[model samples]
Target: MPVTVHFAAGPAAWREYHDHLPRALADAGVQAEILLTAPDPAAVDYIVFAPSGEIQDFSPYVNCKAVLNLWAGVERIIGNTTLTQPLARMVDPAMTESMVEWVVGHTLRHHLGMDLHILNQDGVWRNEITPPIARERPVAVLGLGALGRAAGEALAALNFPVMGWSRTPKNISGIDCHSGDAGLAAVLSRAEIVILLVPLTAGTENLMNAERLARLPKGAVILNPGRGPLIDDAALLAALDRGHLGHATLDVFRNEPLPKGHPFWTHPRVTVTPHIAASTRPLTASAVVAENIRRGEAGEPLLYLVDRARGY
Candidate 1:
C-alpha cells in the first residue's frame, strides 16, 4: 500500500500552495493525502502541516513518520508539547533562488541609484553620478543560516565586502563572518547596507534596537526579510527620522495585514512589501518534503530538520 500523506492547512492552501506540489510528490512515488482539517492521528502516515493550521494534538499519531512543515519558520509550532515526533522544516531551492534574486536586485537597485535615473526626464546628461564600487560598500547580513548565507554569498560574489553575523560564529569559505557583540559591532561599523534575516528567537528579539541601529554607518540602507520582531519598529522609525538610515525596504512584519493606518505606508524612505521575498513555491517544496519522508523511511537523517533546542 502507498503511504498516506495529509495536508492539514485547510482549503485555501489547495489553491495557494499545494496546487503544483502533488505532481512533484507523484514523481517521487509518494502518495500524499492533504487533509483540510486534522484527521485521526492513527490513520495518518505522514503529515504536511503549517504552523497556522489546526493540528494541535500530535500525540495521537503513533505511527507517523514525520511532521513536515510547509512554512520555513516554525516558531509558533516548535513549543507544542504533544509534538515529540521529528520535525523537518521546509527549504526549497526555488524559494532560495527567488530570495537571492529579490535581495540582490534590491541591493543593486539602491547601490546604483536606479530610481533617480528613471525619474529624471530633464534629458540633461548627468555625468557626475558615479556609483560606489561594490567592494567598498560593506553589507552585513544578520542571519548566517541557509537563506542568509546564500544572500551573503551572492553579495560577496559581487565583491560588496559582505559580512554575515549570526547568533553563533559561522566560518564561510569566502565571506567575512562574525557573531556576538564584537562581531556585530565590526559588521555594523562598516556596513552601508544592513539586511536582517534572523528568525524571531528570544535571543534575537529586538536585535536591531537603538544601540545596534546607532552602530551602523550613518545613512545606511535597511532590508528586512526576516521576522518583524527581530527589529524594534520604534527604533527603526526613529533612526530614519534622524537621517541615520537612508531607506528601509521591509517584507515581513509583526502583523500580517500591516494595518492601513501604519506609518510605514506613508514613510517616504520606507518601502513595504507584503512578504514576497522568500515565498515557498510548493513544486520545489514538495520535492524537499518527499525526499525527507523517503529518508525517514530509509532510517537516514532528514534534510533541513529543525533543532528544537536552538528554537530554529
Candidate 2:
C-alpha cells in the first residue's frame, strides 16, 4: 500500500508544490499519495508543513511519522506543544546558493563603496576616494549553520579575513571559528563588516544590544539576513544616528513589511530589503522532501532533523 503524504502548507504552497512533488516522489521511487485534505488524519504517514499553513493542531494526525518544514527557520512552529512528530527543517541547495549571492553582493557593495558612485550620478567629478581592497577588510559571520558557513567561506575566498562564531565551536576549513562570550567580543571588535545569521531563540533574542553594538569598530557595517530579533532596533538606530556605525543592510525584521512609519524606512544609513535574501524553490525543495520521505520509509535517519531542545 502507498503511504499517505498530507500537504498542509496552505493554498499558495499547494499551487507551487502540486506539480513538482509527485514527480520528485516518483523519481525517488516512493509510492505515495499526496492529499490536500485528509479526511482521516490518522492515515497520514507524513506531513508537508509551513508556519503559514492552516493546520495548527498536530494531535489529530496520530500516525504521522514526521513533520517536514518548508522553510529553514522553524521558530514559528517549534514551540507548539501539539506537534509531537519528528520535525525536519528545509535546507535546500538553491536557497543556500541564493543566500550566498545576496551576502556576497552586499559585502562587496560596502567594501567598494558602490553606493557612493551609484547614488551620486551628478555631472560633478568626485573620484578622490579610493576604497581599500577585500584583503584589508575583516568580516565576521555570527552563525556557522549552512547559510552562514557558506557566506563566510565565500567571503574568505575573496581574501576578506573571515571570522565565524556560533553557540558551540566549529572548524570550517576557510573560517576562523570561535565560540562563547569572549569569542563573540573578539570577532565583533576586529570586524569591519558583521553579518548576523544566528537563529532566534530565548538566549539569542536581542543578541546585539547596546553594549555589544558599542563593541564594533567605528564605521563598521552590518548585514542581517538572519532573524530580525537578533538585533535591538533602538540600539542600531542610535548607533547609526551618532555615526558610530557606517551602515546597516537589513533583509529581515522584528515585524515584516516593517510598518510604514518605522524610522528604518527613512534612515539615510539604513537599507531595508523586503526579506528577499533567500526563498525555497518548489522544484528543488520538492526533491528534498521526497528524499526525506524515502529515507523515513527505508528506516534511515532523516536530514536536517530539528532537535527539540535546541529549538532550531
Candidate 3:
C-alpha cells in the first residue's frame, strides 16, 4: 500500500495543486491519496496543509505522522494549541530564488537611487549619486538562515560588502557573518541598506524598534521581506517622520491586506507591497512538502522543523 497523504484544502486548491502533488510525490519516490478535504483526519498518516484550509483541529488527526506546511511562515498555524504535530516550514529552491531576486532588485533600486531618477521627470541629472562599487556599499542582512544566507551570498557575489547577522553565529562563504549584541550594533551602525530577513520569534519580535531604527546610518533604507511584527510600524513611521530613515520597502505587515486607512499605504516614503516577496510557488513547494511527508513515514529526520518555544 502507498502512503495515504491528505491535502485537506478547498475545491479550488485541489484543482490547482492535485496534479502537482502526485508529480512531486512520484519524484520523491512516494505515492499519496491526495484528498481534497480530510473527512477523517484520524485515518490519515500525514497531511499537507495551507493556513487558510478548512481543517483546523489537529487533535482529530490522531494517526497523522506530520503536518507539513505548504507555506513558509507558520505564524498563523503555530499558535493552534491543538496542533501538536511536528510542523515544518517550507524551504524550497524556488522560494530562495524569489527572495534573493527581490532583495537584490530592491537593493539595486536604492543603491542606484532609481526612485529619484525614475519617479522624477524633472530632467534632474543627479551626478555621482549612484552606489559605489558593490565592495564599497555596506549591506547588512538580518537573519542568516537558509533564505537569508542565500540572498546575502548573492549580494556578496555582486561584490557588495555584505554583513549577515543572526541570533547566533553563522559562517557563510564570501560574506561577513556575526551574532550577539555587538554584532547587531556593528551591523546596524554601518548598514546603508538594511534588509530584514529574521523569523518571527521571541527574540526577533519588534526587533526593529525605535532605538534600533536610530542605530542605522541616517537616511538609511530599510527593506523587510520577513515577518511584519519584526518591525514596530509606529516606530518606523516616527523614524521616517524624523528624517532618520530615507525609505522603507515593506513586503509584509502586522496586518494582512493592510487595512485601507493604514499609514503605510499613504506614507510617502514607505513602499507597500501585497506581500509578493518570496511566495511559496505551488509547483515547487509540493515537492518539498511531499519529501518531508515521505521522510516522516520512513522515520527519517524531518527538515526545517519549527521550534515551538521560539515560535518560528
Candidate 4:
C-alpha cells in the first residue's frame, strides 16, 4: 500500500517541492502518494509542515504518523496544542553549509575589521591598525547543534580558538565545550567574538541581559544568526551606546523585516541582515522528509525527532 503524504508547507513551497519531494521519495524506496491538498485529512499518513503554511490546527490529521518540518527552528509551531504527531525538524546539508559560510564570513569580517577598509575608502592607508591573526582571537559559539557545531568546526579549522556552550555538556574534538552558569560566564569573559546560535525557549529568553552582556570583555563583538529573543535588545543598545561592545551583526530579530524605525537600523555599530544566514533548500530538505517517511514505514526510529520536553 502506498503511504499518503500531504504537503502542508503552502503553495510556494508546494511549487518548489512538488517534483523534488516525489523524486526523493522514489530514491528513498518509499511507495508514497504526495498531495498538495489532502481533502481527507484523516487519510494523511505524513504531513510536510512549515510555520508559514496554511494549516494551523493539526487535529484533523488523525492518522498522521509524523509532522516533518521543513525548517530547523520550530519555536513558532512547537507550542501548538493540536499537534500530537511526532515532529522532525529539517537538518539539510545545504542549510548547514549556508550557515557555516555566513558565520565564517561574518566572523572573518569582524576579526579582520574589513568594514573599516570597505566602507571608508577615503585613501587612508591606516597602516598602523594591524588586526591579530585567527589564533590570537578567542571566539565563543553558544550552541552545539548541527549549525553551531559546523560553524564552530569551521572557525577552529582556521585556527580561531573556538569555545562552545550549550544548555548541557557536549564533547567535540576541536571545540572547548562548556555548560551551566559558571561555564557560560567563563566563555563570555575571554571571547573577543561571541556568536549566538542557541534555540529560544522560556529559559533562554533574554539570555543576554544587561548583567550578562556586562560580563563580556570590553569591545567584544557579537554575531547572532540564532533566535532573536536570545538577546535583549535594550541591553544590546546600551552596550553599544556605552562603547562596552564593539559591534553586532544580527540576522534574526524579535520583529522581522526589522521595523522601519527600529534603533538597530540606525545604529552605526549594528549590521542588520534579513535572516539570510541559512535557508532550507527544497532538493536537500525533501530528501530528509522522504527518508523519515521511509523510516516510519519500515518501523525504524525517525531522524532528527523533536524532543517535546526540550521544546526545540
Q: What is each predicted model's overall lDDT from 0 to 1?
A: 0.85, 0.96, 0.87, 0.95
Name the runs in model 1 displaced over 4 angstroms.
Answer: 16-19, 31-39, 120-127
114 Cα displacement, candidate 3 (Å): 0.9
Top-scoring candidate (lDDT): 2
- Candidate 3 stretches greater than 4 Å from native: 128-130
lDDT of 4 at 210: 98
Query: Over the stretch 243-293, how does candidate 2's per-residue lDDT look in tens digits?
Result: 999999999999988999999999999999999999999999999999999
Clashes of each: 4, 0, 1, 0
Please, what are the lDDT tens digits per residue for candidate 4 over residues 1-312?
999999889999888988899999999999998888889999999999999998898999999999999989989888999999999998999999999999999999999999988998898787778999999999999989999999999999999999999999999999999999999999999999999998888888899999999999999999999999999999999999999999999999999889999999999999999999999999999999999999999999999999988988
lDDT of 4 at 52: 94
Error of 3 at 87 (Å): 1.6
**Which candidate model has the greater lDDT, 1 or 3?**
3
Please state the error at residue 266 of candidate 3 in Å. Answer: 2.5
Reference-based TM-score of each model = 0.94, 0.99, 0.95, 0.98
lDDT of prediction 2: 0.96
Q: Give the alpha carbon lDDT tens digit for every residue of 62-149 in model 1.
A: 8888899988898899989999888988888988898899899899988997767876868888878898999878898999888999
What is residue 132's positional error in candidate 4, in angstroms? 0.8
Choose 1 or 3, whichever is better by TM-score: 3
2 versus 4: better lDDT goes to: 2
Ranking by lDDT: 2, 4, 3, 1
